[model samples]
Target chain A: MLELKNVSAGYGESSVLKGVSTTFEKGKLTSIIGKNGCGKSTLLKSILGILPLSSGKVVVDGNNLHSMSRNEIAKKVAYLAQGKSTPDMTVEQMVLHGRFPHLSYPRRYQEADREIARKAMGVVGIYHLADKPLFTLSGGTRQNAYIAMALAQDTDYILLDEPTTYLDIAHQRELMNLLVKLANRGKGIITVMHDLPLAFNFSNTVAVIQNGTVVAHAEPSEICGSSVLDEVFGVKIERLPNDKFYYDY
Target chain B: MRCYMKSLPKNKIANIYGIAILLLILSAVLGVLLGASGISLTDMLSSLVKGDIESPEVKILLYVRLPRILSGLICGAALAVSGAVVQGVLANKLASPSIIGVNAGAGLAVILCSAFGMIGGWSLSAFAFIGAFLTVMLVSIAAKKWGASRGTVILMGVALNALLGAISDTVITFNPDVSVMSNDFKIGDFSSVTYAELIPAAVIVLITFLVLITLSNELDVLTLGDENAKGLGMNTSLMRVVFLLMSALLAGAAVSVCGLLSFVGLLVPHAVRRMAVTESKHLIPLCALFGAGFVAVCDTLARVVFAPYELPVGIIMAFLGAPFFIFILIRGKGGHRNA
Candidate 1:
């Protein structure tokens, strides 16, 4: 479990996350949904220790996030930031980088590391695209490559920020299904989602942020038919059968 | 065609390495054998075989052509590898040693060293590295602070390059006594190179390059960008600083040896990339080899193209690099692939 204790973080002088207290449970896919500039991404970064918490603590299991080294923290959790650019390298090389946190200085990618990477690529079904350069692949395939990289990190918790942003609907759905699959395998999958209907329906729990604070954190059905989504996102969401939902546009 | 579309596989990259080594060897042989000396390659080889090191041909081969050729290789490799590193770390394609003020920084340092009297080779290289390190760090920090975009970083580099060049000119103007500030040095020539000057710079470049090669994987991870690199547990800031420092060392040592040889850094890496050499392990070593061969070949042309009256090697580089840079711009690959 990753727990945030009254976390406050921001860029330079302007505080973005004004005391955002939240807990990301293990073995479940949690979706953080918020309006633009509501500190949803900022909150994820804070949890990953990518953005320094101004006033609170990020506790992973029992270890404090800030006290740990980057690698040590990486061993505890993996992160996938938004807007991943395609670098010039083979997909296998990209996946192999996931084994980076496991290596020490004078970092070597040994056979074991290669095995792990191969396993990761297999997990995301990108094993066939292993030899292909990342830049040549389509949006969905590239997202899989990146997710494969994250999976290769082999951490208990994997955090992604808007993984579906630039991808098309089909790719987005494919990515959500993959995330759900990973979550089903008992990995703690936490993603900052922009697609409200997808987030509320697909994730095991939904974290709704308003003005840098999580105004509602509960099971999607528990928050359904409530006024929180309307107040926070300024939209109405109708819950459908079988725990699915749609925006009342 | 498929090979051109993607990063080369290990064996293909090795094959390219094979080609690069051949080019370097051919350039070195030509550099040693084809000067203004009336002595033939046969004469020099036969003399060395006979242990007759006193011959004028052998002396020229051993002393003049050899040092010049060696320094060309060292300087060329240094600059090119450094350029590859800069391009990777900053994740900008337009940034190179010359554009990013590294050459100017080292040029200023060399000029200052000359003004202080012709100091030892080590101190000159050290001063050059210090100067280059400072300039690049300033540019990097400023870019970070401003949250400069990919193109913005290159623009910042252009501005810094111009600023540093102006300062160098000012220093040169003030200290006309400094011989290194003369036209030949500014344009980058190996005509006056000595063993004392070449050895120190060579040592630094080689060592720094090897260190960079060991950290090449980190460099690859770095190109993944700050957030991903940190997510992968890399200390992004530290690795960036280390890479920048190594790059400075390389640019400095090369500049210390041969004034400011522009475009070897700019040209060789781009050319290597066109060959589909993407990762730093392949990128750095290959750049070193190709850069060395390319500069050696250029310097030989400078020496013999006009015969006794030699043009500076920098002229050849400019003649080549400027056009190639334009071609890249026209093709719209001048920015980062995704940028």
Candidate 2:
């Protein structure tokens, strides 16, 4: 399990994640949902060590995260950031980059490296585009390409920050399904998503972040109700005939 | 079948192949005949095959023309490869040793050495290497402390170049052997190199070139941006240090051997990228060959164009490279942000 205790972080002067504490269990698809500027991305960044924590302890599987080297942390946790773009590399080359932490000095790719890359690309459904230059690929394809690179790392914990942002409807569903599969296979998958329906239906648990704090953490069934949605999203909820809550603009 | 083949990388591959062959042939042929005491093309060829020094011109051709040509060839390749690495790492086309303070750093080191009366052909080269290394180290430090954003680092490089240039100018103004030293180092004449003295510089360039080619793939990965590279498990910091060191070695070697020849460092890589879209594997080699060939051709023209009264290779390159640089600047007007 990945756990953060009293995590407080900010850009330069203004603090964004203020004393937020949360626990994400293993083998569960945990979705963090919130309104804009609620420190959702900041939470993920702190988890990935991209953003410095002002004062907090993050532990993964009984080891203090702050104590581990970036390479060591990278071996255990695979992070996917929002607005990530593919480099001018082929999909296979992109996937193989994930193997960097596994190799020692003067690293060389063995047969197993190629197999792992191939398998990861296959999982992301980008195996056929392995030879295509990443710049030439569509937005959805490129996103999948990056996800595949993360998967090739074979880390136990997968943290994604808005993975479905630029993807189409189908691609978004496909990516969410891939996360579900990964979680089912015992990987700790945590994603910050804007799609409330997908978060409610696909994720095992939903963590509502509001005002720099994770105010409510529960099973999706319990948290997706009208009262909880209004409290987190800061909008009055109306129950529609479709049994889904509707909110005014 | 033909349509499918056309859509493949055939055009780029063919262009590269044709250019490589043509450059190789031109370099070999031009290296023989372009000298102060010009040997006729036929005698230059005949001397090589027969090992017969029948004509007075043939002896000069054998010794002077061969060594000078080799110097241009090696230095060009070295500068071009250096530029390619820097550009790749920074992901910016404008980044080059000349623009960034690598060349200036080497020049300043040699200048300081000359001031202390440690000036000689070989020792001067060593000073240049030290200078280049120091400049790169300074830039790396500045980059790290002040956010290694591509634009910020490039600006720091320009500032360093100006600072070093001022120091060099001040030293040259006060020095006793100012005229001769300034003239030799400023314009980059190949006439100074002999066959034997050029070997060390040549070997250094060759070894660095080989090392650079090995890292081209890693460089390609780098151009994808840092986060992506890190996600792949590559030690991004270590890779940057290695690349910066290698590029510094290359720039230092070229400046030490040939003085400051601009444009070849900046233009060759840009031209290569424009003509082809491949990973660094193909681009780096192409840059090396093209850089070497471009300089050789320019030097040959400098020797033969205003024949006997010969221009410096650096001057000829300025003439060739300046126009192209201007064209790029104008065409690049308000289009595509500098990377």
Candidate 3:
């Protein structure tokens, strides 16, 4: 389990996350949703320790996250940044880097590391593209490649920031389905998403952030009944006949 | 399948290594054989085997040509590997010791030491490394202060290069006795290199190379950008500093020996990347070998192309390197960064 207690973080002098507290349970898919500039991404960065905490602490399995080394944190949490450009390398070469924290000095990937990487790529259904340069892959496939790299880390928790951005509707569905599948297999997954319908439909838990603080942390069905979405997003959400909610400004 | 198309088979990697080794050997032999002294390959080899260090031909081969050739190989490898690391760390293909003011900074430092009559070989090399390290630090600070965009960093380097070059010129103008020495340093020739002068640089370069090889995996992670690298459990800032220090040591050692030889750093790494994959594990070693060969061959041509009239290897490198630099800019490979 990962827990953030009154975590406040910011960039330079401007605070973005002010006393945001949230707990992410294992074996569950949690969607963090908020309006633009509501600290959704900032909260994720704070959890990953990429942003220094202005106040409070992040604890993982009873150990303070700040006390752990970067490699130690990496063994427990895998992160997929929003969008990243890699150098000219094949998918396999990129995925092998996930084993970096696992190897010692004069690091060389052994047979066991290779087997793990291969299995990770297989899990993402990109085993065939392992040899192909990432530059040549489609946007959707590139996201999958990054996911495969994260999976190769073999962590219990995975955090993604806008994994569905720039992806087509079909690809988004594919990615969401993959995340759900991972969650079902006993891995904790947290993602920052903008699509309310998808977030409500697929996530086991929904975290709603407003003005740099998490206002609601509940199951999707429980969140759907409250007026919090209207107050947080500044828009009225109507329940549609097809079991979907429509936002009207 | 896409996988089949992208895979780097083991056999191909082996072939690339084989070709690089072959080129290195061929160039080294040529470097030893063809010089102003007119020693043929067969005679040199026969004398070397017989341990005939007394003959004039053998003397020239052992005392003059051997050290010069070895200097060329070491200097070339150092500059090339430095360029490879700079490019990787900066995430900009245009980043090299020469272009990013490292060579110029070292050159300025060496000239300053010479002007001040600080002529100790080891002290001179130490000064060069300090100068190179300071220059890179300045460039990095400026880039960070404004924005660390690739263009901003390269432009800052260019500005620093001009300023350091001017200072070096002023120092040389006041010290007339050091003018002749400055001329050789500026043009970058290997004719004046002695075993005593080459020893310190050779040791530094070898040690740095070994250290870099051990850190090649970390370097690969760095190319993915800071946040991504941190997410993978790397201390990105610390890694960057270490890599830059290694790069400075490499360029500083080479510059201490050969003056300001340009473009081997840029051209060799780019050429090696084209021939092989971009993984630092392969790139660093291949760049070192291929770069050594490339400069050795270029130096041999500069020596023998015009009989009895020697051209500085830097001049030859400039003629070859300038066009390639332009080509890289036009192709926009160095300009590649996500907005």
Candidate 4:
């Protein structure tokens, strides 16, 4: 479990996350939904230690995150950031980089590391693209390649930030389904989502942020019963047939 | 060790290395034999292989031609690899030692050293490395602070290059005694290179090259950009500093010996990338070999084209490099962050 306790962080002159706090449980998919620039991404960055906490603490499995080295944090958590560059690296090479935290100094990939990356590539179904550069692949395929790299990291928690922003509808559904599958496989999946219907339907838990503070943290079913959704987004969640959902403005 | 990357398989890299080695040999031979009074290959070979140094022609081969050729090999490799690393770490295709004012910084330091009568190879190279390192850190920090665009970074480099050049000129104006160095230094000629200058720079380049090769894979991770690299557990800022330091050392050493041989850093890496060799393990070593030979070839051309009135090797580079750079830019493959 990863826990953020009264954490506050910000850019140089302006505070973005003001006393934000949350808990991420293992073996579940949690979605953070918010309006644009509501500090959803900033929340994730603070958890990853990419942003320094002005006050308060981030605790992961009883270990204080501030005291842990980046290597230690990485061994327990993986990240999939948005707007990834299309570098001149093959899928296998990209995936293999997930083993970075596992290696020692003068780090070189071992045969065992290769075996793990291969398994990760297989998990994301990019095994056959081992030699293909990411730039040549389609957007969906490239996203899968990055996910494969995260999987190769083999951490208990995987955090994604606006991963579906550029994908088509079908690809978005496919990615959400993949996240569900990973969650079922006992990995903690935390993602910042934009699609309200998808976030409410696919996620086991939804945390709604309004102006850098989470206003509602509840189970998906509980979200509809509260007035927070309408109060924040001015929308109502309507359940559809076959475990589907719709947002009515 | 036996892994395979696409198109550039291990065997293919081996073949490329083979060609690079052969080219280096051929260019070294040409450099040795292309001076004002040309020595035949046979006589050159006998003078070299037999270790005969009594004759003036053999003395020329031993003293002047040999040191110059050595400078071409070592310093060229340093500059080219420096360019490759700069491009990688910055995630900009257009970033090179010369373009980003690294060479200019070193050139300024060299002028200062000469003006101060600090003419020893060790002190000169140390000053050069310090100057190069500080300038790179300045550009890098300014870019980070302002969130500089690719074009803005290049503009900064141009501004720094002009400013440093003016400083060098002013220093030379006051210290007329150092005017000789400033004159040959601007165009980057290797004719006056000596063992005192050559040895220290060569040592620094060699050591830095080995260290870079060891860290090549980390560099590839860095090119993936900061957020992802940090996610992968790399200390991004620390690694960036380390890599930039190595790059500065390389450009500084090259400038220490060869006096700002322009465009080899920019040109060699661009050519290497065009060949689809992006992995740093292969890219770094290949750039070294290819760069060494490429500079030797250009230097030979400089010597042979005018015979007695030799042009600086930098002129040949400009003629070749400017066109190629323009072509790549126009083609929308400016080696941008698009990979």
Candidate 5:
């Protein structure tokens, strides 16, 4: 389990996350949703240790994240950043980089590492495009390739920042399904999302952040029943009779 | 479905390695045999086997041509590998040692040392290394201070190159006694390289190559930008500094020996990337082999084309490298990253 207790973090001169406490349970898909500039991404970075916490502690399985080396943290948690540049590498090469923390000294990838990368690519359904350069792949397929890279890390927890951005509706649905599948495989999957319906439908737990603090942390049903999203986003969310949702600004 | 997506077949890479080694050998042999006093292949082989330094043929081969040939091979490989690492670390294809002020900086230091009559042996190379390292550090610091974008860094390098070139010219002007020597050094020639001058550089280049090859995997991960690399558990800043120091060591060592040779660093890496895999492990070795061959052949041509009146190898490299650089610019491959 990864837990952040009263954490505050931000860029220079401007705080984005303030005293936000949250726990991401293992084997569950947790969706972080909030308005733009509401510290959704900042909170993720704080937990990943990419951003230094201004106050408070982030603990992973009873060990303080701040006390561990970057390599140690990477061994337990994998991260997929949003909208990476297209490196001049094939999907297989990109996925193999995930094994970096596992190897030492000369850092040669052994047969076992290759097998794991291949399996990770298979999990994301990009096994067919492994040899193709990432620049040649479609946006959605590229997203899948990055996911394959994250999966290849073989960690218990994976964090993604807006994995669905720039992806088409079909690709978004496929990615959400893949995330849920990964969560079902006993990995804690945490993602920052903008799509309310998809987050509500797919995630086992929903964390709603407003003004740099998490105002609501509950199950999808409980969040949907409350007025959290409407209050945070300054919009009216209506639940239709047919089990669909509509948002009116 | 188990789809095996192999990027480049193993045989193809093996073939590339084979071709590169063969070319290197061919160029090396030609470099030795085609110098001013031509020695036939059989004669050269017999001289090598006889091991008689007293014989005129053996003396010329051992004392004169052998060091020049070795210098070309080592310097060419050094510059090319340095360029490839710089390009990878900066994530910019245009980031060669020559273009990024490393060669010019080393050249200024060597010229300054010569002007002060502090020439020869390890001291000159040490001075050159310090100059190269300082220039790279300055450029990186300035770039970081001023937004640190790819374009910004390249522009800063250009500015630094111009400044260093001007300083070199000033140093040469004040010391007219060393004017002729400075001119030859500026254009880059291997005729003056003796064994005494070549040994230190050779050792540094060889050791640096070995160390870099061991870290090639880390270099590949570094090309994926900082945040991503850190996410993969790499100390990205530390690796960048180490790579930059290695680049300086290579450029400084080569410049200290052969003056300021241009474009082998820029051209060889680009050419190798076109033919083989982009992975640094494969790219670094292939660049070393192909680069050695390319410069050796170019040096041989420079020696033979003008007959008794030899041209510096830099002229030939410039003629080739300038056009390719422009082509890269026109093709929009020079600046790949917005940052």
Candidate 6:
């Protein structure tokens, strides 16, 4: 499990996160949903050791994140953001960059490394574009390419910040299905999502944040109830007698 | 078009690198042979193999064009390799050492020293090195405080370039006699160089090339973007400073030898990347070979194109290279970063 304790972080003194604490469990799909600037991304970054916490501690798999090296944390968790503006890298080459933690300095790729990268591309269904330059790929294709890279890292935990922001409906479902499959295989998948319907239907657990703190962490059924929706999002929900779902808009 | 778009089978990029270098060596040899003296290939070979410097033609060839050829190769390689590093580090296609004012800074300092008559007996190179170091220092500070965005770095570079240009021009204007010497020097001549001046400059370029090549992997990570590289455990700021210093050293050394030659650094890497992918592993060696071959070819053409009155290789390169560069840009494929 990845756990954050009183973590505070920001970019150069504008402290976006204020003493937030959360734990992401293994073998589960945990979705974080919040309004704009609610510190969802900041929480993920702090847990992954990308953003240095000002005072508190983060522990991942029993290893203290602050005490360990960046490479060590990289091996434990693979973090993917919404969109990467990388240029000129082939899909295969970008995936191969994930094997960095396994390779030492003067890094070289063995046949096995290529095999893992190929497998990653296969998993993400971008195998055909392995030789295509990343810039030429469409937005959805490029996002999958980065996801394939994170998959190639083969870490225990995968943290994604709005991974489905650019995808069409079909691709959004496809990626959400892929995340469910990854979680089913006993890997922890933590994603910060803005699409409420998709997050409610897909995730095993949802953590709702408001103003830099997680307001509710519970199963989808519990969090999707009318009262929880009204409390978290400040919206009143109506349920029709014939319909099985609650609607809050 | 379908066949063309089929995934390129991975030929070992290193193999291509080796082939390009071999071709460069061959071109450099051919370049050294063809000159105004017109020594026969047979006589040149026999003298070189037999160590018979007794022949005046052989001695002249060995003493004169050999150092000049080596200088061209080294300078070309230095400029191209540094260009690749700077482009990657700044994440800007146009961020060459010259464009960023490192060359002007060194060139100005060298001219200033020569104009003042303070370097009456000293080597021009030490002054060039100091200028180069200062330029890198100034640019680094600017890149930090101002941020190394594509717009900011280039604007700062242009501003610094204008300042250096004005200072150099003012020094020349104030001292006309020294201006004549500086003008002759500024035409980018390699003909009259002594072994003393050539050896140290060559060494500096080689050392800088080695340093840059060693950091090619870091450069690969760097080009992805600063945040990505930092998350991958690289100290991004430190790497940028080191890269700028190396580029300055290389450009400064080249200027000390051949004055300010433009377009080789800018053109060579872009050309290499256009033909190949943008991976630094392939990019660096291909650049070295192509840079050496390019300058060698341009220098040869400069010598023979208007025989008895050699054109400056710089003028020839810009005249020849600029249009091709514009064509690449206009074709809407300035390689991946620009697109």
Q: Could you say which candidate leads in lDDT?
A: 1
Q: Could you tell me the TM-score of chain B in model 6? A: 0.88
**DockQ values for all predictions?**
0.53, 0.29, 0.59, 0.55, 0.56, 0.32
Extract clashing residue pairs from model 4: none
Q: Kindly list the per-residue Cα lDDT of model 4 for residues A1-249, writing each as its tens digit.
A: 999999999999889999988899999999999888999999988999988999879998998977989988888889888768877888888898999999877879888888888888777777878888888898998998889888989999999998898899999999899899889988999999989888988899999999989898889878877889888888888776666778766
DockQ of 6: 0.32
TM-score of chain B of each: 0.93, 0.88, 0.91, 0.92, 0.92, 0.88
> Which CAPRI level is candidate 2?
acceptable
User: What's the residue-level lDDT of B19 in candidate 3?
Assistant: 90
The global C-alpha lDDT for each of the candidates, from Candidate 1 onward, is 0.87, 0.77, 0.85, 0.87, 0.85, 0.77
Stretches of candidate 4 exceeding 4 Å from the true structure: B1-8, B44-51, B180-183, B323-339
Candidate 1: segments with Cα more than 4 A from true spot: B1-8, B320-336
Error of 2 at A43 (Å): 3.6
Candidate 2: lDDT over CA atoms?
0.77
- Positional deviation of residue B260's Cα in model 1 after best superposition, in angstroms: 1.2
TM-score, candidate 3, is: 0.94
- The sequence of per-residue lDDT tens digits that candidate 4 reaches over residues B1-339 is 323323325676677888989999999988887788777777877776777778667888879888988998888899999999998888887888998999999999988998888775799999999999999999999998899987889899999999998898898877889853655677777878899999999999999999999998799999777998998889999999999999999999989888978888888888887666778988999999999998888787877888888888888768766787678656745555453
Q: Positional deviation of B244 in candidate 4, in angstroms?
A: 1.1
Q: Where does candidate 5 chain B have its weakest 10-residue lDDT segment?
A: B330-339
Q: Residue A212 of model 6: what lDDT? A: 74
How far does residue B266 in candidate 3 sit from its true spot (Å)? 1.2
Q: Which stretches of candidate 5 lie over 4 Å from their true place?
A: A241-244, B1-8, B45-50, B178-181, B321-339
lDDT of 1 at A190: 93
What TM-score does candidate 1 get on C-alpha atoms?
Answer: 0.95
Error of 5 at B267 (Å): 1.3
Candidate 4 vs 6: which has more lDDT: 4
